[model samples]
Target chain A: MRAEHIKIGTSPPISFEVGSGECLAIDGPSGSGKTRLLRALADLDPFSGRVFFDGAEQSEMPGPAWRGAVRFVAAEPVWWTDTAREALPPDEACRSRAVRVAAAIGLPAAALDQPLQQLSTGERHRLSLARALADNPKVLLLDEPTSGLDPAAVALVEELIRYRLLSGNTVVLASHDAAFSKRLANARIALGKKPLTAHAP
Target chain B: MSYVALTYWDLVLASLLLLINGAISFGFRLNLERSLAISAVRMVLQLALIAVLLKFIFASDAFWPTLLFAMLMLAATGYEVASHQSRRISGWRGYALAGGPPFAAGLVTALFAVTAIIGAEPWYAPRFFLPILGMIVGNALAGAGLVLDTIADGANRERQVIETRLALGQSRFVAMSDIMRRSVRAGMLPIMSMMATAGIVAIPGMMTGQILAGAEPGDAAKYQIMILFLIAGATGLAVLSAACGSVLLMTDERHRLRLERLQSNGSP
Candidate 1:
């Protein structure tokens, strides 16, 4: 995934490219367009720059198709339906995979059958990531993936990100955890910092 | 059987009913007497003017006047639909989105009724075309208004939820498909309720009017059935058109939900 000269709201022009199997951490202060940037890259937010996946412009492709390949898991995850399963994809295979992913994310498989209102905030957050991964996206846009998780759960989420990277999927993670970014990301870009530079590739 | 027409004296007697209601309202201090008087005045004046206009229209053999009148009614209805929305789509976009559906549906259904059903000598005959078109346009206009209002409000309220679906690689159509169904269903509810309750709880106005105008009970029933069918058809078409239009207006070619495009003028 490559985003070039992307400007959203009051943020400065930002650009970066992470190759297949790579993880790029977007670090920023609060209100520094971290969420907005990820959304722009995913084509979920309006922005003024170009985004490309494997040399193909995001705008040139159908939005849904582009979005399918570049999945975005929002920080405050939204569930429109009652059941957790309904919030995921409708296919049976995806449902089973979601159950597996939910378990892997430290959520019980029974979580999928539970009503949305019954799920904890941590569960909702993890479930959103699980739902995004169910599609096997080429590029995953995660906003604050482990914000509300316990230390153990955060470690598990980081492990999952590493696992995703090992399997040749690209990830753009927006996080305030600089230590975690350094531990996992191949490169890091900080918004609201003067002379923003892409770290060692 | 011949029907008796109400005379000026009968109208005077009808005024007594309103006076009685006003007296009761005033005695009870219900604060409704002023509104009741105003409503009565408007209804009498508007109906009187419409009757005069209809007389002129019915006497005319030209089709242009009839078409113009239909357009006028459609425009008024479009304004009503747009005005009723909580998040208004301003300017011509609002007018087009609100008015276009009901007009097209009403006109098409009216045409179908005149040509296929009624088989009038001249398809645009004032007597046949005016009343049938009025009924169709009126009902379709109300349905379209409800549909537009429901959809606009729904889209605004469900912004995050829809964007989440859109980000999940669901097409705008697929992402908001459920809401669209819900909005259209809500829009059609009144018509559905009226249809369900027709003849059991209420005799529809058109049927009652037909029966009072010396038409046979069976003939009135038949006409009512046809009108009901036309109304249902028109409402469906209008709701479908408005739903599509509202969805299109709410999104861009890139299939993003542009909620910013939905501006408000402080009127819901």
Candidate 2:
């Protein structure tokens, strides 16, 4: 599956591709359309382009099925629910997995019952990650997933990403953090620079 | 209206509350003077006009004019809600789509609860019709208005989040269900607050009006309870209808929020 043309706002346009099961990390300066690319691919942005997933038409498939595979988690997630328990799926298996994910990410077990307003920024971000991971998507996209986290939290998120990648998920993480990107990315895609750098070969 | 019952101290307290309101605006250095004055002027002028219109309109036995007036009021209420939420809601049709379901549902609820339940005279008498319709329209306005603002802002701000869910195989309505519930809950706060107050905060306008018009306080209080229940019912229906209608209206086959139409302030 890939995106073509991909214009957003009045900014210069960019396009790219994602082969099956290959984890790609979008690395560039802030406001470099990394999130935009993900949004466009997710069919969330208003763009003039073609996007396809696994030879099936993105526009042709039911939105639910298309979205079921393609998921994007924003840097600053807006939660619809106030409680952590309400945020995750009600299914026992998914709920227990979310609890495990939250604990691995350094969130307290009590966070599940606490109101969202009570959680710190890092905890909230972890909750967002846990929610996305619960959906168990084929395409797990993250926008600066560890940008605001402390060093320990960042390492934990990296561990989670690595775990997902090991599970054969197609992971695309967008970040400007070089050291973090190098550690987890199988291929790096950069944006918003004068000359293109293709080093994945 | 006994001066003995309403003492000079009661007058003093009401004035003191108004004075405190004015003082807080000044004390906090909040610059609300221009809008405050304008709002006060508009309130006075509008109420004076309504008083004059109601004097003659209430006395008339003819139902056609009253019905026309009620319909126009409902349309106005709906228009206010739409215009307040988005400038892109171009014309009557755009407003109608946003406004129609809530108004119809609210009116039906109000009619059933009032005539069937309260047993008002002449069935559609203007006295009952105007006040009952006014209450319905007023609450419906608040509920519809809340839905409009929330949905418009929600569709834009949470567009990506919503789209993410849809891409992940969540149906459009399923994606919005949580957000819709939250928005409607926020909308119903005012109604809930009013219900909490009732007689203790001074009788509501409907009951107060009936009392002044020579009805016994006990009789008016029963009617007030009925009106409150109907108004609450109408608001619930209006809010739910608006939320569901707006979501359906704004979604296409791809399940994307129709931003083009709203951004242009026109229907997609």
Candidate 3:
């Protein structure tokens, strides 16, 4: 997955590329554009740039088709359905894949039967990841997927990301958690709360 | 039911309540003090002017002045409703889209209910149409205003979610499906529920008024039922119209919420 010079607000555009099946972790403090960068690649945030999904450019394909192929998990992903079971894709293979993902992320199997409102924030985050995994996406964009989790939960999420990478899913994760970044990222990009300073004197 | 006259005490009590509300609102946040004062003055002036004009309207043999007054009221109310709601759209186009459908539906529905449904003798008579249209227009205005505000607020606040959909390759309409459902539901649910529970909860205003005027209970009930149907129809049309208005703002013919038009409030 590649995003070339994504522009937001008035910030000088920055671009980065991640090799297929590799993991690139982005870390920044609150208000930094880490999430924004994920969104731009996902096409949620408007920017003047290019995004490449495999060899195909995002510009050529229909936006919905593009979105389906490249999945994004929000920091606090909004669940529209009643329960975890309802959130998964309709395919049987997808459903089983989601179950495995959930288990690896430390979500109990019974969580699927419960209403979304019953899940804790960490549980909800994992459920979102489970949904993304079920879709069989080529590239996964995750935003603060482990921010609200405890150490054990974070470890589980790390394990799940590692598993996805091993299975040949390209990953782009945005977070402020240094511990998670150090463990997960093949390459690290440090960003600032505000645009980096440049001077003309 | 107890009969209460519009006596001096009633007027005093209403005024006192309004004043108390103002005082409390001011105490908590004086951010709107100047605007509030201007609104208070406008209300006093407008009502005072209307009271003075009513005497001349009723006493005069000619009906043109009275009709003219009603038209002015309709236009003012329509403008206020449209302008207040479509701040994001922010122009005459917004005003037209916001006010046009509701006004049309409310006017037509009000006429149908007042004339054919309730069997009023002179359907076009301003005396009947004016008051009934006021109520219909008021509801339409509220309904349109509610839907637009909800949709815009929903889009702006949950921008990340919306943008995520857009990015993932959903066209504007496809992407907005979940949000559209939520916004419309939030706006329209109350009106529908009120209609469902009308007589059981409390006698509606029109029915109670007709009963007070010594109309037969059956006739009053019929009239109230007609009003309910008209309101429901107007609200339904309003929901459709508000959605149509918003569709233009968000997307091109392809039905994509234009990336530029979608403001990012907390998107990052």
Candidate 4:
């Protein structure tokens, strides 16, 4: 996946490229357009410049098709359905994969059957990550993917992401967790009040 | 028996009843007297003007004049529908989105009713066509405005949920289907309730007017029922179309949620 001179909202033009099995950490303080940058990459927000996935331009494919291959999981999770199970894509394979990811991320199987409104903030966040991972897109844009998780759950999330990386899926994430970034990200970009900079870790 | 004509003095006497509302406002210090008086005056002037215009159209009894009057009413209905929206698309697009569906639906429904059902001698006769078009279009305007309002407000409130679905690769239509369904339901609810309770809860205005004008009760009841059905049909079509149009306007071909396109009334 690659973006060249992408400008989102009032932010400066950003450009980056990540190969298969690589993780790009977008390091930035709060309110530094980290989420906006992630949104641009996902094509959820309008941005200038070109994005290419596997030699296919973002605009060349339909929005949903492009998004399906490059999925985005927001920091603050949102559920449109009543129960966790219903919130999955309503397909057999996705549901089964969601269950597997849920168990791996320390979420009980019973939690999937319970009403999402009854879940804790951290639990909902984990479910959202599980939902994204179940799709198993070529590229994942995660914004604050582990903000409210416990240390144990956070470790489990890291493990799951590491597994994804091993399987050759690219990831771009924004995180305040320095240790988490250090552990996962092979390349990094820093966005702040100062001009943006990118470097290999 | 022929209908009795009301004198000017009779209308003046009837309007005197508004003083009771003015009295209540004064007694409670509600400060509503000014608005109430202005509304009363405006209603009287508007209705009197319409009465004169209708008399002229009926006297002329020509197709072009009647068609022109119907078009004028439709334009006015469109304006009213757009004005009622809280958060509307800006410029001519806002008015077109609010008014276009209802105009098309209402015209089609009224034409079908007049030509096929009622069998009016001249399909565009002022007597039958004008009144049927007026009622259908009026009800459709209400329904379209309501559905547009609900969809706009719902989109704003559920931005995150909608964006999540979009990010999950759901098409824009699929992402917004739930809200569109709810908004269509909201728009249709009023007509459904009215149809359900028409004869039992209250005598409908058209039926009451027909009875006062000395039409047989049975015939008046039949016309009222037919009119109610036409209203329901037109309202349903208008609302469904309005929801689809609103969803299209709210999102783009790129399938991005463009909430910035909507602006609250009275804001820059």
- Runs of candidate 4 with Cα error greater than 4 angstroms are A9-11, A194-201
TM-score of chain B of 2: 0.77
What's the lDDT for candidate 4? 0.90
How much DockQ does model 2 earn?
0.34
Better of 2 and 3 by TM-score: 2
lDDT of 1 at A13: 87
Q: Is candidate 2 or candidate 3 better by DockQ?
A: 2
Worst 10 residues of 1 chain B by lDDT: B259-268
| Higher-scoring candidate on lDDT, 1 or 3 | 1
- What ranking emerges by TM-score with the best candidate at the front? 4, 1, 2, 3
Docking class of 3: acceptable
Per-residue lDDT value at B166 in model 2: 64
Order by lDDT, highest first: 4, 1, 2, 3
* DockQ category of candidate 2: acceptable
Q: Write the per-residue lDDT of candidate 2 for residues B1-268, one digit (tens) a residue.
A: 4223446687666655655656778889787756676776687589778767777787885678677777777678767667666533445656885668567866797678658876767777776777777877787778777776777677777776676566445777987776787778877887889899998987798888778777889988998897788878888888888777767766767776666566444442
Instruction: Please write out the lDDT profile of model 1 over residues A14-114, one tens digit for every residue.
Output: 88889999999888788777888888988986779999998799989989989989988888888888877887777888788778777887998878778
Candidate 4 chain B: 10-residue stretch with minimal lDDT:
B259-268
Poorest 10 consecutive residues by lDDT, candidate 2 chain A = A192-201
lDDT (C-alpha, whole model) for all candidates: 0.86, 0.74, 0.73, 0.90
Please tell me the interface RMSD, in Å, for model 3. Answer: 3.5
Model 1 has fnat of 0.87
DockQ of each: 0.73, 0.34, 0.26, 0.82
Q: What is the Cα-based lDDT of residue A187 in candidate 4?
A: 98
